[model samples]
Target: MNKAINAELLDLSNCAKEPIRTPGSIQPHGFLLALSDELTVLQASANLGDWAGCSAAAVVGGPLAGVIGEDGVQRIVAQLGPELGSHPFYAGTVGIRSKRHFDVLAHRWDRVTYLEFEPVDRAEAADFRHLYPLIGDFLLKVNEAGSIQMLAQQACEHVRAVTGYGRVVAYQFDPDGHGHVMAESLEAGYHAYMGQHFPATDIPAQARELYLLQHIRLIQNADYHPAALVPALNPLTQQPNDLSFAALRSVSPVHLQYMRNMETLASMSVSLIVKGKLWGLISCHNRDPKPVGFEKRTACEQLGQILALCIESREDARELQFRLEVRRIMVAMLAGLTQGSNFIDNLSSVFPDLLRFARAAGAAIVVDDRILLHGDTPGKEEIAALVDWLARSEHGDLYHTDNLSRAWPPAAAMVRNASGLLALPISRIHKHYLLWFRPEYVHTIEWAGNPREKEAADKALHGAPLQLSPRTSFASWRETIHGSSVRWHAGELELALEFRTALLGIVLERAEQMAELAGELGRANKELEAFSYSVSHDLRAPLRHIVGFSDLLLESAGSEDAVQRQRFLKNIKESARLAGKLVDDLLSFSQMGRAALRPTEVDMNDLVNSCIHKLAPETRGRDIEWDVAPLPVVWADPTFLHLALSNLLANAVKFTGQREMARIRISADDHAQETVFHVDDNGAGFNMDYVHKLFGVFQRLHRMEDFQGTGIGLANVRRIVERHGGRVWADSVLGESASFSFALPKHEDEDEADDGAQADNPTKQ
Candidate 1:
């Protein structure tokens, strides 16, 4: 930095020794310029054929502001101040009066403010030379990279060296248009208003626009006006479409009064644009209106032209490097998917450049709605809750640097000296939010003349200085934002919109890849269903053949043998029957997968009655009491529903087969969302522990030799009920009582029909 300072001073000194190359150019007889903090005399040339009344040595190092009247300091700081910072300055001709006029050229070398004044008789002010090209190389350099840091130093050095002011400092403009001293290359023991802020509206729109265009400009004497210029007939016209160097001929009296209040005069600047956007400024200040005569003004013009390019080139290089790095990180995120890698699990691979670009303290990612902190020891569940809250907020915009640690509902966790928080909604589900935690100092530029130093000083002055915590602690924002306002960047919203589009596309592409993986899972499920169907049909075919052949052989050999032969045939016949039963069970198992419900409204009482009627012959002559109760209507396939109910009814009857006073009951209960029907019997019951095994095909609570079952009856009932979007459950205890109940969704269509008349309801089954 010191090297840069020396170079800036050396360059200014070299230009001072440079002899005027253009003979026809206007030169000052003797012009004074304010530098660092003092005043000095710049070169005087022969073009002063009329203004030679003064010599260069007389005005040089003179108290410039002191030389003018009381209004000198205020007028100079207010009018010619902006030329120092952002855009280079220049001066143009405007007739002051019908008979009075002067030739003017002005430029700001940062803090060293210079204005060359050549007063002439109205008939002739043309003696001033064209001096815009002297600093062409420097202007081009600033335009390419736009580094205000270097420009500020040069402007200050020039002001300090040429004008010899007490202090020359480059005041920078915030996005809100308020100015702050960004740099100060002044003499020792000279510091005043280095970090002070100047109003945006004070300069107004017309003056601010002028700084973006020209390489040189001036306000020869801000307080020199005799009368305000006439207003133009029309407003700003598109005819002169370009407005880089906009100027207002008339002055507003209200604003003039405001300037008087501030006691500032003389301003000039240079424009520093970053990423095709105007970033900030380079402004120079003066305390007095030392006549920066025509010769010095011409020199200031050459200086403005050269410094513009130098500042631009230096700033552009830094931005180029940043953009390249961000692009690389974006590429890595894209590559993660193709490699079959867990992109969310490894945030570093996806954004290897995140910490590089931002001095983050920690990082995390939210993938598939799961939040994970990336590091040796990840954050607790509180971080996940914080992430969820942010994702659901109405402000979907990313939070560049938010302190969530001390925030409500998440006050337990805090990160100190946190640089910034990035709330990126990078996915459609918004599951991907890249959190970049950085140190606070990384974002804040260290300043030697920071205005806040006074706030700190006030505490020290009282000897009650506040002790600030270490950098890694979360601090309150109330202090930093107190009574100050800024618009971080102009057109910032448009830039965010641009990044959103690009990032949204990236997130969508990742979503598509996830969908593809899900498609593969769906295919696997379909394959398993197909395989089960094929095995059921193929295996049942051979069982059917085996049962048929065995039965035939037994019938043919029946008469060939006596008792032994008959017993052997009996065994063979039993084996064939068992084989047939197994085939039937396998067929039932396969049918469950293929069955589709044909839901219709039906009276549960009638369905159960019909099923009972079908089983009457099997229960003939048995002393069994039948307790048939009324049943409500339910939605189910009539045939399948009958099969389901009949199986339960038959089991009730069969279990009571050995009982002397056997009883059977058919009943149901109506529940609003559904109707439940049951066939319960006081018969030989089984333990409840085996109940879960009751509804699986070929899985029976009892052996076939003892209970005589294909082992698929209950499973079939379950399948039928499930097809109707209903369910079945059983309750039984050894030798006490047993009940088989099933539920079916009661469609609203059955409500109009009475339970007794529901047998005819079209949707009932």
Candidate 2:
């Protein structure tokens, strides 16, 4: 029954929203008085009679002088200023009716002045004079400590001695809000809780916020009853006073119950605030009732402030050292990345430095589809999947997680090797990344109690509505953690970001170099083509003169030695004709490279007919069967398209010259993005092994004596198609047939031309 009740009461959603600031009461060790700006009493604690020798009814609607006398009222008024509105001010010791002395603390809020009075012993009051030296000695010891742990241990010992508590501990909170007992000091035989962990629920979010506002809190006796205010409300506001900064503010019953569960009668907590945040606390616990005077508590508060500064200085020093090491590694790795060299190769050479820079167990470099892994890493397929997921889910250039399984469920399978992942995307456009991995760091946690079970057993046995009671158990519990790696510190993350910037610089520099080299190569190629075109054009007239002179010489020769003369003339004419033809092909190939395209809707059927008609003289006497399919209309330069088609058809006819019966076909295939045309012929095809060389200028599989022509036809065809934003390729069987194909991109406005074409039946020619 308790478990069920606790489960309902301890729901975090309800507990976090509990208003714990206005409890309308204070601890019985002190009494409170609420007065207006004019020193008129508006409210008083019900137990004020016990301290001031006055009845609660008498104090109601009375003047401040009636409680502590006119001298005490003057003392409080003299200390009042703008600073008193925010924090409570110490008004020195005041006597009530010349009997007992009490330390008065006062503050003003919302037109009401709240004064709290706590009785002080004469000896405890004198202890204030000795506080300066005690703190000075503690500061000397703290400064002499070598590390944060040593400093914490020294602080625990000093606080225990001054407060006379049975045990004192330095509790530090992790990034996740879980507390760990970093250091401890205790009396002989006292239970030791050093190195124990506590769940975040031990101090909820609201409780932490309160600690930030009030740096110190004391519970003189955990079992003491709270003193309720007379009339239960302030007359000025008609509501409970906000005791956020009250020294005698009543703590939540849940916290009181928690102290009792630990067998602690009295406890004091001093907050360690670093960088404007609550870092942790110096917690003191007593086995018996122990009341610490105001002066000693003030000393402890100052001690906590000094300790916070030391901690901040030490942490900064440590981070600075780590950053320097990362910087050294970065310099070495960057030096290895020589400009114009392969980026992946250079990075691979410095892979060890890369891993050290991130302080990771493994690293992976992803460039396009290739992945290079070094040190310890997950399987390639798993890494690929993770990269794909990151690409889809993360838009930032950097992503990191200490618990990969929690962020991506699929990572659970590979938790052993990659429980942590730090990703840097070098190129999102190419899906390139640099990843660092950390293996699982499995360990056991010694918790103060079974956090889960205790939270589920926090029942308010008194049936208080909207109250989240504390756990009733304090047994030590051990829990084994899984599927998490060592956390990535802020300094390491910052270094990773710096390295990312450096890597991007290298990648950008290499890309720029490649682009510049490509530009240079392009200019050189154009200059070579222009040179070839100029030489070919200049040789035309010289070859024509040789042919003309040889003809005249042969016609004017006498009958004497006519046979010898005729032989010489024939050789001269043949050489000139071959040379002339070679020059013509070279000029055509050069022109194709330099020509710009004039794209229009081109009728493939009409172009094929024109090419065939130009090849009529070569195919007129042959027994050839021509099958031309209805081809799709394409967007291309008509003149270039005509030249390409003419060369392909001419090659088919020329290669099939020896066949008794020849077969030739022209066809096309239309796709969403392009149109492909094919020309196939049953001819004396060459070997497929030499097909790669067939499109080069002057490249041939057969001898010139057998083919009887210059070998620039296919080269010119490729250049023309390429200049029109298309590609050309050929395939052949050794002795059976050959096929040539070219594809052109579809233009945006080609749909109308395609719809009107006759593409349903074959056209016989």
Candidate 3:
């Protein structure tokens, strides 16, 4: 008994992999003929002799013309073309052996053409005069319908009226491949299947594939015995013909049993294809054997095509409207983003809008380790764990799932609030993301029957063979679904991606602004440290000297030694003068750091001459050789540049005072990007090792007696040059010549120069 049960389970699993295409037989209501490229008959159905008045074996090796007559064969040949591969081409009604009229349909597969012949039912033949107007009216109603449900109802009614079936239904498939009867038209005695659902397994995967290939299928009588091919295979290829596109192809035994269980003896299905995929079907079922003629089935096929277009149109318009709504909500959220300084806070403030944008029940804004939740959501710990999983799984920037528990096992614990998830990564480096969640949509599904009844019944059939059959019950069976939410639509995912892109832009902008501010703060702190050091050490020296000299003068006031008193007073006066000079220089250096740059075009030649003129008093008794070269006009602040040049030239003259003939040269080298101006002086230059300290306030390599000035001159020069978006450096050899050079951009951009200045001395702004 257990062995039999195992065999049944194995058989049911194998149903999905069934090869229904090459059934090696066809329905007895019609006969099929397989012909080679040379027109010779390769195979013939056993039931063909009933109409052709000749046995199938006698016609297997003969030409097709021998069975269908020469004129009939010519008609079939003339209609043969490339279109025969995709669908059966109707070759008009032809008399077989001049005894009976049959509708001739031809299609090609694997180097062989299959000719299917169904006896023409004259009484049910389609009248174009009636069908053309009926189809027009049906199309008009389909267009006039405002919704999908309404269109589906109209389609069912029209199909039922035309086919005269006992019942008709418009069956639509969900994303999970389950069928739902959207609309139905039924006779008084027929069972009502409206609003009922069918399991996805009711129609196997292979059957759905055929539905896409063949737009329409008709089963004349479910109880009729299948007519086997005479040779059981095509003699040319020694294989059964692929009857996927054949009009009278044999139905799968399981599917035939499915119809019998439903009390439906004959049925026809017209595939409603949208965008080249099988969207649904317009199914017609009859209690008694019913044969729909070729013309009538063609009309029904035409209606199905029209209905597909209408459905596609409605769905597209609906999705477009949804996308537009998402855009509007996104715009509002982004507007809110700009109003706040913090990204997470701004996003949190517009949480309601975000929920609406994603059509989600809850949302979470995660920035690094911080997680902010809004509306219905899992606990913070759960959300963090989910994010960690996502990061490790590497599902890319965007991920969405209707059943989160299936993708992540731990999510089963949070099914109530996080059954569905949509995640958009903002910054992978920081683990920043935007996640939307949907609560589990607990609902009861009214299936047409217990979808698992067949398996259950198989266990009872202990000694039965490995044969699968349909369920015996059609009663309403309610099943409660859990741990899942309504699936996310394509349009919803697309809008989320768009929102992510826009959000990333905002995030990047904020990051750059933060970096800029950080840089400014660092520079300010360094400047403050340097300023404090200079005030403590450099200013203390001058004050100490003055205090010492004053004390000496006071002590000498009562000595009555006139010469000694004069020397003491003189020392005090000199110390006081030095202290005042030091104070003034310190003030000037501080002012330079806080000064804003007002730049303009300045001629270096004129500036160099001006500096020389100002130093005339200092160079009066000195033998100085000034070699000034022609200089280029540069973009810089005139006041700052003048101060810098005066300081450099003054140093050159003062340091070169001991020379018999001192030489000072001012020259500039022009390059593609910048102009480098250098001041060379044959002076008492310092050692090169202390060059880094040359730009610090009150930093001096030479002693006070050797260089008789505060060490703020070179520091001032550096500050001024840097403010103009230029760099200053000095190269010197001990007791030899020194060179100081500064380079400025040839064409300075005002904004860039200002930014550079602010970066160097942020206190200026």
Q: Provide TM-scores for the models.
A: 0.40, 0.66, 0.66
Tens-digit lDDT string for candidate 2 (158-204): 88878899999999999989999999999987788899998888898
Pairs clashing within candidate 3: none
Model 1 misses residue 729 by how many Å?
A: 49
- The segments of candidate 1 whose C-alpha lies over 4 angstroms from its true place after superposition are 1-101, 104-118, 121-148, 156-168, 175-282, 293-306, 329-338, 341-343, 346-354, 357-359, 375-378, 394-399, 402-419, 430-432, 442-765
Question: Which clashing pairs does model 2 show?
Answer: none
Q: Best lDDT goes to which candidate?
A: 3
Per-residue C-alpha lDDT of model 1 across residues 1-765, encoded as one tens digit per residue:
011112221222222222211111221222223223333323223222234343334544444443332343444444454435423233432232222344443444433334444455443434334343334434454445335665666556664555444455666566567666666765555435555554443344544444445433443233433221111111122121121222212122222222222232443444554333444554444444444444454455456444544444443334334433443444454445345444454454644444543434566766655766643223646557657767676445455534344343343234442323555665433456666554333233323233344235334433333321111111112123311112212122222332343344333334434545667454233433433442354333433454354344345442322344335435534544454445444445445545554566677778877988999898898888889887776666688888888888888887887788888888878887778877778888888998876766555566545676665678678766766667788898778788888876656554322242223211332
lDDT of 3 by residue, 582-602 (tens): 655655676676677887778
Clashes of each: 113, 0, 0
Runs with alpha carbons beyond 4 Å of true place in candidate 2: 1-13, 123-127, 458-467, 520-765
